[model samples]
Structures are given as structure tokens and as C-alpha cells.
Target chain A: MSTGSAPPILETKALTRSFSGFTAVNSVDLTIGEGTVHALVGPNGAGKTTLFNLLTGFLTPSSGTIHFQGRDITGMDPERIVPLGLARSFQITSLFEQMSLLEHLELALASGTGLTRKFWKSVKVLGRFHDRGMQHLEEVGLADRANQAAGSLSYGQKRALELALALALEPKLLLLDEPTAGMGLEDVDRTIELIQRLRHGRTVVFVDHNMHVVGSLADEVTVLQSGQILAQGTYDAVRADERVITAYLGESHA
Target chain B: MSEHLVGTSHLETAATAAPERRERAWARPLYLLLALLLACALPWFIYPPIALDILCWGLFAISVDLLLGYTGLLSFGHAAFWGSSAYITGIVAIETGMPFPVAILLGALAAMVIAVPTGWLAVRSTGIYFAMVTLAFAQMLYFVANRASGLTGGENGLQGIPRPFFGMELIETEAFYFYYAALPLIILGCFIAWRTVHSPFGRVLLAIRDNPARARALGFDVEGYKIVVFVISAGIAGVAGGVFSSGHGFASLNDLMWTTSGKAVLITVLGGIGTLWGAMVGSGILVTLEDYLTTLGFEGIGIVTGTMFIVIVLLFRRGIWGSVQQAWHWALGKARLRWG
Candidate 1:
């Protein structure tokens, strides 16, 4: 395990979330070190998404304490959480369908700056963000489709745009839910490369089913089954765990 | 196979290339100039009072469109702001004898103040719940106005709401004179709506409308934006209401009735939801039709308007202006293909 000398960027103590009477996530503790690429891997119904929801404050935990950058952020609203250097991407590709790709990045950029409150000014003021917006689109290889509407993009392209939007936030801790969930082989490779290039100084916690992605990019891997962590270590160490094999990896990778 | 693929791709590019160049026709300088000229000539064509009605209702409809079209909010209690502004303007004109502009401003301010609490409660809900909440608030205000007869003149309404002189004795409170005086304020209100939707703030509103969850994840205060827009819309509606009451020399309980709120919604839907200028077009058609039918001693105006609304919805689901915009782009694409 590469739990290096770096401090923890995010920590959760006894996080639990239940719906109706069924518990989706049950008393799980997690620590993510600063500037490390971490992956949460498991089979279907492993409660990985529920954990993400809890972390991002989309869903309030039934019982837990979440500390980010050494501050208590438990039960904070999603809108409030994002400004505190925590940003997340949805598992489903959510975007403004009628808005152009450049407009999407420009909006993300505008929200960070105080330009969103300038209702009286002409839209020409947004011209200042044009260069930076295009740079973001170029990062995802979508510069050519800058003016095109988000609804017209291919599925793989939409996934790339999603990453671009999250990256635009410049978060201290980034949470991505299934970055390459439905991508083809070529797109998967491209995304893996993009994440490798982008995760230089940021802490990234992603949930993925692809072992190949986990093997390549993740510095540390955590395996969860039935809402509890079964194992946590480096890629090879987690892969070699006996319970992980019997529960998840054995069936999927067999 | 490669040649066939290349040919199909070329066709696709041609089809998609046209729309990127097609700007909104209503926003063009030439069209705006034409519209301005038409506004200047309207009083000559119709009864001066009817012309004033068109201008006032146009501003009201545009205010409704600002929330309904851009923000994806459907408020059914807009009449609360409109009617409240009318009453406030009437009272100010009667009590202080302030300049008409000052009175109108105060009325608009009052409407914005009322919107704060009402919008705070209403924006917490979505879809039909939002509409119902706004409607409930309006109904409550209607009852309050009914009971407060000393202030509001109760069922008889506030009469003798004078249109104060504007320094020139020749410019009296005649319908024709008043129509010109009110035209600038209405235009200013419309311009504000246009500027709002085109600004960065407006871009965020569109994003919230399309996906509130995504907008919140992006760090936007979604409810805050809704409340702010709701207040601005109410303020604009108040301006319309102020002008309407002053021009008619009366403010009645009918101004605050739920049907007045419904009229704003109907006019917005009749023109086009998201198209800012469509509100004015819808307002013009509605006001003109009502005036014409009433002058002919016809009481079935609702049936005619209802039928027209159904036909518009069935034929042009995007409403009149939205469909026209689509067709304009399509025709431009066809022309480009044919010429080149």
C-alpha cells in the first residue's frame, strides 16, 4: 500500500445510510491521502454509488462524520460542498442538452468567478472566457465541437465533456462515479490516459468496474462487497486477496 | 463503400452547417426598427385605449415569459404582483399626487417586496406544486383586498386614479398621450427581460432549468437564483400594472383575480414560451382580439381564444414564434443547399 507520508485529504468515520428499512451503506470508514489516485471497485449492488452520494452530500448519511481538508462537512448541501473544493461527476452523463460545449465549460468557469451575477451586462462579456473555455475543450479533444450542442455529441464524447466539466472546477478532492462506465475500448484507453495526465496534484476517488483501469491508474485500490470494505491496498495486493476473489473479482474477471 | 460513406458524411455536414449561422431574426436591428415603427403607428390603427391595453399586457406577458420560458417556472399567481402594483399606483397617485413615473416606480418596488416572501415559499417546490403555491398566495391577496374596502375601495374598486401632468399642458391624460408616455417604460421592461436572458445570470437559469441537480453540483445556489428571478419578474409585472391602472383611471378587485394571472400564462403560451419577443406578439393578438370582439358586442371571446390556443398548440407545439424560428432556419438551410 502506497499510503505515503502525505496527509489525508478526505476521511469518513462510521458512515452509514439507510433507505426505508434497508441499509445501503453501513458504518464504513474511508481515508484518502492527498494527491493520490484511489479507486473503489466491487460487483453490482456493492453500494459504491451510495458512498459517493454520501461523500458529495447528495444524500445525507444516517450516521457518520465526514472531514474534508480537516473540516467537518457532514450533511452540507451539494451546492455548498462544491465551493469548499469538493466537486463530483454523476454516473449518468448529465448535461444541458441545448447548450453548446463551449458554453458548458464557460458556465463552469463563470460559476467559479463572480460573473454569474452580472445580469445587466451584455453576453459579450463572456468573450473574456472564450480562450480559457476552448483550452478546457482541447484538454478533452473536443475543441472542434466547441459550438455544437451537448445533445448531439456521441456517448463517448459526452463522457469526455463530463470529465472536462469536473476538471474545470479545479477541486482539491475530485469524486468521479464511473468515468468510463459505457465507453468502448478506444474511449476507455483515452479516458485512462486523460485521468493519468490530469490527476497530477489533485486527490481523485473514483468508482470503477474495469480492472484494467484500476490496474493502470489507481495508486491504491479498495474492494467493497455488500456495503463494507473487504480489502484495501495496492492494486496487486487487493487482486491477490482471497475474499475479494470469492466475492467480486473472481466472478467478473473469470 | 468508402465513397458512399464520404458522400453521406458530406450531406450530414451540409445539413448541420446552416443552423450555426442562423441568428434570431427578432433580435436583428432591422426587425427591431420595424417593430418600433409599428408600435408608434398602433394608436392610429386601433382605439387609443386599446393600444394602451396592448402595451400594458405586452409588458405583463413578457414578465411571465421571463420566469416561464427562461427559468422553466410556471407561476399562476403573477396577477398578485400586477394587481398589487395597480392598487399601489392608484393609492400613490391619489394620496401624494406624485409624478406618474415616481408612482409607477413605487408600485414596482412594492410588487418586488411582495415577491420576496411569496417566491421564497413557492420556489421551494417544483412543477405543479410551484404553480399551486403561487396561486394560493394570489388568492389570499385577493381576499385581503376584498376585505380592506377602506384602502382598496373593496368591490367598487379605486376610481379617479388620475394620470398626472408631465410639465407640458398640451400632453394631457388622453389615451393617445398616455399610450406614448407608457410606451417607453414598457420597452424598457422588455429590454431588461432581453438583457437578463442574454447575460451570464440568464445562462445559469437555463442550466438550472435543464438540470437543477447538475447546476447545484456545479456550485450554483439554485433556489437563490429562482427567488431573484421571481422578484425581477414581479417588478416588471408591477410596472405593467401601474401603467394599466393609471391609464384606465381605476383599480378594481378584478385586477387581482386568478383569471388575470391565467391571461398572462395564456398570452405567454400563445406567443412562445422561451422567445422573449413572442410574449409581446401573443399579448398583441390577445388584447386586439378581445377589444374587437367586445366592440362587436360579442361575449364569446373566451371560446375564440380557447380555440386559437388549442390550434396553436396542436399545429405549432413550440408556439408561434418558436416554430417560425425553426422554419426560418430550415428555409435558410434549403436555400443554401439549392444555391451551392
Candidate 2:
């Protein structure tokens, strides 16, 4: 529950990534301040997802470093980074199709506590898990659908459950990859309310193509294009800039 | 009944329940007593040698099933370890005269030693590649066993392997003593396997089988876990093979052959892939059927067993035990829907 004008919780120093002789991301330096809602907005294929991947250990950077709380964490695997209080919900809904939504989060929450698969003997003592898990489901307004198959949930409810599982981690830094990616207007409004509630005491870095969400919730905005930082400022400043308009809008904004 | 009310969603709820963990606590020892009674009767009704042979083979299948059903890694070359241990156990028992159990320990050590190197490679891959790598390596072990005449039996195999059970010079009149002697080893082996499967470590293995990448993301040492289980599985197979050598009083290159591995695979498939006891049931049905068919002057149990494999594959993805589980669920589900 860190707060205030403290140092950036996550920062990339000249981070670069190349794949199969193609430069997917190049020298994209970004900073996400502690307990702030940082939005990364870009067109499709603008390497926002690639930057998210690098930050979250889904992809290794070709060069440069990532620092969390001023410690160089470059090239660390996702498993190791998790114990350091960084957790991420997936871009694609990667819920176990066969598992119930409650089961999915219970297992996630259990593992997030650094519990390994063996020692199933402690399964009898899972009362704390249920209590905390139900609280998380309540947070994202998914308490009613707690027992549903995650895959069977409507597109928006699935996203909400995914958010609830991320909340279960109680992470210092949360990476939400398009948390409201495919939702109805009502679902999107609920997601915004949920996001607002989550922005205190924990840092949130999210990527979305939706300008409206970004404009409303972002404390600061970083715009990416082809893996490089195209612009960085407050939402109004970046949205009003002619460069952002010309670079991102193409013929549509004109 | 309340469990069924949640419907398919309850499958996870039931699986995740705190109270259901106690179900298997008592069931295991009950099975052990039943195994003891069966072992006692093996020598009573059948020739001691044949019954002893079945026990050894059955234990071998059980070991393979641990890897297949519980761990979800289908190994086609378990014979490499099982066969090699038979030779080692056969050689050591004759050379050392160091009691039966001690010799079996040495044999298990040998198989475990081999598994470290081979399993390191096998666990690096998954699915069809895992099976292929294991099968290829086993064939490699077979060739080495065949050519190494100085240490191994070269084709003839080590002979006159002996076991002193109950402080008596084992006599032909008491060939059934082989069954009696191998009983404790089989029981110990099965008990450990069952215990390990029921443990948290086994659940992790199931998690790995269902979704390995997720397990990795959750901070599991996925490959390391696989290699450890591989070695343990090999050790169990080794002990089973060790018992086989003593029962037959011989161990040969035939033990190391690919067909030796295939036999275990055949039993696993016929019994059901992921059902551990189903493998045991498979061994019982297959071995007994072969014995019955041979008496009827029908030498080709292959054609019949082969057809059974196809039918089982097509008819039930859950295999024998799994299908029974699925049907029980479907019935319970229907009953609940009606009542509710």
C-alpha cells in the first residue's frame, strides 16, 4: 500500500527487443510512478503489448535494463519476479477452460502465496483462501458468478474475473492488459468504477486502444508506436498535441 | 447430493473441498490387505513360478502407470531401466549373496543412476517428443546390453539368481516361496507409489500435465520436477524387474529389448492411460488372458489385445476407470437434476 510522490515503482532504461531479425521494440524508456494509474495507449501493432511483455517477463529485452524500486530486474523470469510483488493479468483471457472461475482464482491465489503444488495436505486449511477470494470477487462485482466456468462467462464478466484474480495477488504493481478490452458500455462503465477503486496504494500500468478510458483514468499517458515512445504527458496534453494526432490518427483524425 | 446441485461448476468445487481429502486416507490400506490376501493365494492355486512372474510384471506395469496416469508423461522406454535393473539385480544377487532386499536396493540404485542422465534429456521435451525420446533411448540401452558380453549375459543372460527367504534354502517343492518372497517388495513398492501419488507433489505433476506453462508461470521448477518423478518411476520399475529376476532365476538381454517396454505400454493402454489401478487391472486381464489363450492352443493373443486397444481408444477417452468415473458423474448429475 505504497503512496505519494515516491520514485517510480517501475522504469525501463533504454529497453530494446528484437525478434527474428525484426526490431519489434527499440529503446523504449518509460516510467510508471508509485500508486499512480499510468496508461499506455497506442494503435494496434504499435508495440504497446510488446512493451507490456518486456515489463512482465513474458519477453526478454535485447538490451538495457528494467528497475523496480531501483533494483535492476532485467532478464528475470516471471516466476522469480512474482515474489517481488509484481503481478499481471493476461491480454488474452488465459483462464483454464475446464476450471471454474472460483477454482481458477483459488489456485492462482494459492500459488501467489508461494505455495507449490505438492503438500496438498494443506488443502483442508483453505478457509483463508475462500474468504480472501470471495472478497476479490466482490471487488470486481463478480461475486455472483464466482462458481461459473471462467470460459463460459460473457466476454466482459470473464475480464472482470481476470481482474479479480489479479486483485487476489494483492500486488504492489499490477499490469492490466486491456482489462476492459471487449465489453459493453455498461460493462465498460463498471470496469472504470472498479479501476478507480483499485488506484489507491498500488501502482497500475494498463494498455488500451480506447482513448476515452485512457483520457478519463490516466494520471499520465505514454504513447507507443512501433515499439518506441511517441509521446509522454498528461492525457489532455498528449491528446491535443498535433504530433500525436498526426502520428496516431492517420487519415481518421484528420 | 448437494455437490451435484452445483452441476459442472461443482466439479471444481468438489475437487477443491476441504473435507474430501480424507476419502483416500483409509481406502489405501484396505487395498493393501486385499493385495496381501491375493498374494497368499497365488501360490495356493497356480504354479509358484507363473504366479511369481505375474506379480513382478504387474508391479512393473504399476510403476509405468505412475508416470502415465498420475504424471501424464507417456514413456515408451521404461523397459530400458526395468530390463537393465533385472540384469544388475541378477548379477549382484549371484555375486554378493547379500540378502534379497539388499540386492534389490542395489538394483534400484542402478536404475536411478541411469535415469538421471536419460531423464534429464527426456523431460526437456513434452507430449509425442517425450515418448519418442524415451523409446529411442531405450532401444539404445538394448543395443548396449546386447553387445556388452563382459558385464551383461551377452544374449544368454546371468543365470542361477538366488533368494534366501525366511532363513531356509529355497527348494523346488516350495517354488511358491518365490511368490511369498516377492510379496513384501511388491507391497512396499505399490504403497510408496500410492503415497507419492496422493501427496501434494503428485498434484503438482497433474497440474503440469494439464497445463505446464501455467505451472511454470506459478514458479514451479517444471523440468526438475519431471526428472525427479522420472527417476522415482524408474526406481519402481527397477525394483519390479529385480523381483522378476529372482523369481525366474535368470536375467537376459531379452529384458532390455524394446518389446519388453512395449509390453508395459500395451498394459497401460489396455487398462487406461491415466488410471493407476487400471494399469494393474490391465496386467491382470492381459496376463491371465494370455495364459488362458495359450492353453486353448491359440498362440496369437496379440490380434485380440490389439483389437481391444482400438476399441478402448474409440469407445472411451477416459479409459476403463476414467469412463466409470465419468458415467458415475453423468448418472449422479441426472439424478440431481431430477431431484432438484
Candidate 3:
């Protein structure tokens, strides 16, 4: 799928997943090159999130192969895959409800540093990660609210914290499901900026319904419809495709 | 914008100024010292046997709390560990003539060994399923202990289980002496449980408890944490059982009964679920009340305990210690505002 200097960082071949009799994700091929920001945009129930789950190893594919950094990660548990430099953010906020924002970042840092298994040391000793956690908070513009309980954060702020958590993992490939979902215009802009900042040296595959977010952030966009890719190209070219306009965007937008 | 900043900073200051670190550090140790003093003086106020009973049960309850309060893993069959340890400790003492610490250690080890497999099976399931599996395993152990009369004394139980000694007969020593002897084990058990819950590993357990799926997604081995905690909790429960057997000089079928597990749960809930010390508090209160009721010739003391448990559950959703801690924090918040 790539003839350039670096091979694709992640690739999927003939990925298919079915729930009972309903096929949620049909056989699909995907190639994400190193350091590329690829977007998976689709209308409601278009299997975008399903594909994300399959690629991240959260959901097992009925028949397919998932290759991450050229290693077969098919049916691997998400916990195992994450340590190999793949991390994901949930569509919904999934921060620890009782933990403060700083603690949430520290938990991620602990995983990355292999400190979570250290039973004898006090969590306070992981204060070594304090400055880095604060840096993440600052990156997400949440420095002031680092001490606040994560559950008390506003919806948009929670999404930002979720992004900070993913970033703290320092994954080689980042998967964000609806990184800016259900946000106000101002929050959308902030999240877009955060994504831009995060994409400097990382590979990213994100799912979003917002076309503008996709167009601005994604170097290449894949249009999915009814569990299959309808089109894949540069955002502008994909938007201009007649089938995408009719099947996804509708003639009104066209 | 300047005024807004001032207001937010004021709130933050008020929130963070609860108590100084030095002062907060002293609070726990000070409480521990006071608790030790009280445990020392308890035999003077109450009958020595009752005092010893409270301390033993207190350890058992705290062991249960390690799983229930901190990790959100509730076992309805904790008696499998406690009772099995009691029997092992008692048999070891009677046959091997080992010292007190060694016997207890062996018993606790046996309990932990059994916990490994049960925890393996139990942690694979969650919530009610976990509870049911534990209960089922405990019931099987209970029947096994019952049928193995040659080893466990069957339904009659292992009676006259000898206590450990330095050189002389320790069981023959005054109950007060034995009470003092048992106090350190209880305190040490509590300290171990406290330290584990405060460790970074403990934080991972809390993370798993709060959201297993999210914790797993964050690259934590959720089931692994659960099993390790289960083993630790079972080991502590075994310690409690060993102390109980030595103190009572007996190991019986009642120790392994499902009701014994229920009692541990009730004690934890009554005192407060998440607070580690709440288990001991609950045990003290429940045991004292039951003892007093029985002394008063009340045949159905269970009714009174049941009623009190209902009231505690209804009124104190956070349990006694949790509510008390909340109130303490609130008071500190108020004090900080007034002084600052």
C-alpha cells in the first residue's frame, strides 16, 4: 500500500465483523502511513466507529488481519496492543469519575512507565510525573483545572482531558473516536488546535461527523457507508465525488 | 476578568487549605496510637473474652473491606478463607507445637493458596456472578470441612485447639495476657491493609473498580489487579481466622458457614464500606451489641442487629466512617474559610 520511504504504520485487510446476523463492519482495506492524520468520516451507523474498534483490537473481527507496525495484532486485547504504541480515546468521556484531572494523567503516565505494577511505592512518589502531567494539562488548556475532579468538568473540558490522557500514553499511533463530538464552536476550535498540536510526529486515525474538522485535520479521508468504504481520497476530492455527494453529503450540501 | 480570576483563586484556596500536610500526617498515626491505647485498655472495661472477640472479628472484617471497600469486589463466601485458616492454624498448633506466629503464618498461607484458584475463577466474572461463584466455592469448602472429620473434626469441629507459646502453655495464661499478645497482630494486619490501599498499585485497584473497561483500555491488567487484591484480602482474612481459633481454642464448622461471610459483609457495611477502619468499628459495635443482648437473655438478638443494619444502610449511604470523614472534611473547609 506504500512505496515511499516508510511503510504504512497501520494496515487492515479484509476486516469484517458481524453481530449475530447483522454485519456491522464489512470487509475493508485501510492503510495509514507513518505520521499521517487519516480521518474516517461517515454518516450515522456507517461502521466508522466499528472499524476503529476493530483496528484498535477492542472488538475482534470475524475475518480479517490487523497489522500495526507490521506485526499481526489480530484479536489481541486492547490492553496488550496499547503498550505496542497504539492508544485510543473513547467517543464518550471515560475519565475516572472520582479522580482529579492530574491523577487521571498520572494513571496514563504510570501505564506508560510501567509504574502501575509497583505495589510498594506510594502513588505520591509518581509525583515525578507531576510536571509532565501538568504539561499535558497545559497542552490541552486545562492547566488551571488540573486539581478539579474529572467528573465535575464540563462536557467539553472532559473531552479535552480525554485527549490529554491519550497523549500522556505517548503512543506511536493515536486513535480518537469523535474527538470533538458534541462540542460548542469554541470548544471545536480548541480541540482542532489540540489535534493539530498532537499530530506533529504521530500517526492518527480519528472518526468524526463534522466535515470541517475532517477537512481541516485529515490529510486523507475515507467515506464509509453501510459498513463499506464508498470513497477514499483527499478530503476535497472525496467531497467532490458524485457518489459521496449523493450517498453521504446529500445534494443539498453538494 | 480580573475579578473572575480572584473569585476562582479564592475558591481554589479554600478547597486546598483543608489541613496542613504535617498536621494531616499526624492525624493517622495519632489515631493509630489512640486506637492502640484503647485496645490495650479495652480488657479493663469489658470482659477479656469479649474484648478479644472484638479484636479478632475486627481483623476479619477489615480483611473483607480490603476487597469490598477499596476494590469493589464483594465476596459472599469470605468465610471460606477465614474458616479454612482457622482450621489450619488450629491443627498446626495442636500437632506441630509451633510458635504462635508460625502457626498463624502457615494458616494464612493455606488460605491464600486456596484463594489463588477461587480468585482466578471469581475474577473472571463480575458483580452478582462473582458473588455467586465465591459463595458456591465456599459452600463446597464448608461441606468438605464437614465431611473430613478425621482432619477437621467434621461437624463437631476441632475443639480444644491449643494456643502457641514461647515455652510455657500460652492458652493457660490469663485471657488478658493473650488479649495483649493478639493486639499487635490485629494492629499489624490493619497497617498492612492500610499501606496497600495507599500504594500506587492500590490506586490501580481503585481505577479498575471505578471503571474496569476504561482501566483495561488504558493498558492496565484489570483482572490481574482483581486477583492480586483477592489474594491479599484472603490472606488477611486468614490471619483473622487464625487469631480467632487461638483465642477461642477451637475451630468449628460455624467458622466456615455462609453466615460467617455475611457477618463480615454486614460489619463492613455497618461501619462504612470504603473506610478501612470502618470494618473494625462495625465489628466492635456488632459484637458488643450481640454480647449485651445475649447477656440480657434476648433469644432473638439477630432481630436487633438486623434492625440496626437496616437503619445504618438507610441513613448512612457512605457507611459510618465515610460519613464521618465527609463531615470532617466539611468542617475543615469551613475552618479554612473562617481563618483565611
TM-score of each: 0.94, 0.84, 0.94
- The digit string of per-residue lDDT tens for model 2 on A223-251 reads 88887888888888888877789787685
Name the best candidate (by DockQ).
Answer: 3
Model 3 TM:
0.94
Candidate 2: segments with Cα more than 4 A from true spot: A1-5, A97-106, A109-158, A246-248, B1-55, B169-175, B295-299, B329-340
What's the fnat for candidate 3, on a 0 to 1 scale?
0.44
lDDT of 3 by residue, A1-254 (tens): 22135469998899999999899889998888898889998788999888988887789999989999999999998889989999999997787787888888888898856777776677677788899999998888777877777766667777888888888889999999999888877668777877888898899999998888998898888889989988988888888889888886577776
Docking class of 2: acceptable
* lDDT digits (tens) for residues A85-196 of candidate 1: 8999999999998888888998888776778878898766777888998988888888877888887777777788888898888898999999988887777888888888
Q: Chain B TM per candidate, please? A: 0.92, 0.86, 0.92
Query: Over the full model, what C-alpha lDDT does candidate 1 score relative to the true structure?
Result: 0.88
Would you list the clashing residue pairs of candidate 3? B149-B154
Candidate 3: RMSD over Cα atoms?
3.1
Cα lDDT of model 1 by residue, B161-196, tens digit: 977866644344578888888788888888889899
State the interface C-alpha RMSD of candidate 1. Answer: 5.3
Number of the candidate with higher lDDT, 1 or 2:
1
